[model samples]
Target: MRNKGPKIIILTASYGNGHLQVANSLYQECIRRGYDNVKICNLYTESHPFISEVTEKLYSKSFTYGKQFYKLFYYGTDFIQNKKMLRWYYQYGFKRLTSLIETEEPDILINTFPINAVPEFRRRTGIVIPTFNIITDYCLHSLWLHDDIDKYYVASNELKAKIHSRGVTESKVVVSGIPIRPSFSQSLDKSMLFDKYQISPKKDLILLIAGAHGVLKNIKETCETLLLKTDHQLAVVCGKNHSLRNEMAQLENKYRDRLHCFGYLERIDELYRIASVMVTKPGGITLTEATATGTPLILYMPVPGQEKENARFFSEKGAALTAKNQEELLNSIDSLLKSKQKQLSLQLSIKKLYLPSSQEMIMTDILKESEKISRMKNHSTIKSQKKKLGS
Candidate 1:
C-alpha cells in the first residue's frame, strides 16, 4: 500500500522560503498518504547552484536595502514579452533541470517556484509528464503561467479568475488555498500550550514573528510599544536570527515575566494556538499558516511587490490588518486587543480563507491527472503497435 501511489518530484527554489515551504507541505502530505517515492528537489541549488547562491544574496540584499529595485525587477519580468528574454537567460537552468528530470523519470512533476520547468523540459526532451504549478502567492504572476501545465492550484477565486483571463482554461485552475503544514490545522489545547511556554493563561498573548530571515525593521521599538501600550504578554519568535534573539533577551529583565524570546522552535503551531494575535511580515507561507490557525495578523511593513499584494488580499478579506508604520502597528494591535468583536470577526474571516484540507485535495487532483495521463500514453502506445502489426 505504501508503494502504490505515483512517483512524485516536487521542484522548488530558495528565492524565498514560501516556495520551499509549500513544496514541503505537499511532500509531507504525499508521504502521509503513503506515497513511497515522493522526492523534493531544490531546483536552484541542485541544478543551478551558483545562480541560486547569487540570486539568493541579491534577493536578501534587495529586500534589506533596495526594495524599490526589487520591485522594479519583479514587475519588469512580469510581462509576456519580457519573459522571452528571461527564458533565454535561464536556458542553462532549463537544460540542467531537464537532465535531472531525465534522470529521475518521475510520474508527475510539481513546481512551487515561479519557473515553468515542466514546459521547458517538454520543449527540450519531448517528454509529456503530468505537471502542477502551485502558485504560492495570493496573486498570479505571468512567470507562473505555462501552457503545458495540466493544473494550477491558486490561493483564491479572484486569482483563478485572473488566470482564466490570461487565457488559461478555467478547468485547469483549482482554487485551493496555499497548502500549509498539516500541524497548523490541528487543534492544540490552550492550557497545555500556555503551560509549555510558561505564560500566564489569565493574560492575552501577543506573538511577534520577525520572519525566517529576521528582517523586521525596528523590532526593538515595536516590542517596546507592545509592552508599554498593551496589557498582553509578548512572545517573540526571531527565526534563525540569533542576534535579534539576544537583543530581545535584554527586555526580559525590564519587562519581567511578560517577555518571551525564542530563536527557532519547530512546534510553532503550539505558539500560534496560544497567542490571541500575531504581528509579522506578510510572507505567503507564514500568512497561510496563521490563517490555518485562525490567528488574526497585524502585517507590519510588507515588502514592495508580492508581500504587498498578499497583505492587500488578506486585508480586503478581513483576515488581517496592515500596518505601514510604528504608529499604525501600535494602533492596530491595541484595537485588536481591546475589541473582542473585531478579533472574532478576523478569526472567522481567516477560517473562511484557510482550507484545512488543501493538501488532500491537491494530492487527489494530482493522482487523478497522473492516471489520466498514464491511460492516454498506454492507448497511444497500443495504437502504434497495432498500426505497425497491420502494416
Candidate 2:
C-alpha cells in the first residue's frame, strides 16, 4: 500500500557533499516524523552521469590547478543569471526528472541544490507543484532564484536579505539556518569520546575534516605541522578519501600517542562534541555542523568561490576565524588551545550562529507548506467540478 501522507521529493546534487548533506538531513527528519513518501533524487547524477562525472572531476581539480578558472566561472555566472539562457540547462534532466515526478506524484519539490530546472519546467510546462529552494551556503547565487519557486530557505539572515535585494520577497524567505542533523544539537559525554577514541583529555583536540570524496590540499604537511608544533591531540576525519585515510593511518602510527585518524563515519556528533577546535575547509555543511556543536573553528584556506564567501560570513559574524595557510592555521589553533577565554568566546559566537533544532524547524515549515498546497489543490478540484456542472 502507498503512504497517503504528504509526498515530498527533495532534489539535491553531490558536486560536493554540502547540497546532499542538507537533503539527507531533511529526509532523515521526515522519516523520523513518519512521513513515508519522502524521497531524495540526486538530479544531476541520476539524469546525466557523464556530465556529472566530468564536472565532479573538474570541481576537485579546481582546488589545485584551476582555481582561477573556477573563480571566473563562479563569479561570471553568478553575476548574471540569465533565465532565458537557462533554458539550455532546463532541458538537461527534463525527461528523467519529469518521469520521477509523474511516478512519485510528489506534492512538493524541495531543492537543496540550485537545480533551477524544476522552476524552469514549471514555467514552460504549466505545472504548479510547490517548489522550495534551500540555499545550501551562507551566500546567495542568482542561479538559486526563480519566480516560480514558492519559497526560499536560507542559512543566515544576511543571505535572506541578499535574496530579498535580488527581488525575492521578504515574505517568501525563511532564515532556517543550514539544516544539520539534530544529533549535533545535543551534548555527548567527553569522557566516553576520549575512551572510545583512545585519546587523552590532557591535550586539546584539533579536528581536521577532509570532506567526503575530497582530499585536503597538502594534508600530510598540515598533519605534520599540528603534531610537531603543538601539545594538542589531533583527529583527522578523512571522509571517503581512501587514499588520504591510508596516508593518515601511516601518520597515526608514527604519532601513535597523539594522532588519531578515521575514515568516513556514519555519526560524527561525538567527535564534534569532543573537539577543542575544528581545522577544515569552509564547506557550508561542515561549518554548520561545527557551529551546531558550538565548536570553535579555524577555517583553513577557504577556496575562492562559495568557500571564501562562507568563511567571510562566519568571520564577519565573529563566529569563526579564517587562516590563509598551513602556518596561519597552526597559529590560530595554537592560540585557540592556549587561551581559555578565547576558546569560550569563539564557542559562544559559534553557538549563536545556529538555531536550536534547524532540521525540525525546516521539516515543520515544509509540512505546513505541504498542507497549504493540498488545501489549494482540493479547492481547485472542487471549483473545477462545480464549473463543469454549471456548463
How far does residue 123 in candidate 2 sit from its true spot (Å)? Answer: 0.8
lDDT, model 2, position 85: 62
- Across residues 302-332, which tens digit of lDDT does each residue of candidate 1 receive? 8888889899999999999999988898888
TM-score of 2: 0.95
Model 2 C-alpha lDDT per residue in residues 154-194, reported as the tens digit of each score = 88888988989998899889998888877787767889888
TM-scores vs. true structure, each candidate: 0.94, 0.95
Candidate 2 root-mean-square deviation in Å: 1.8
Off by over 4 Å in 2: 377-391
Residue 292, model 1: lDDT of 81
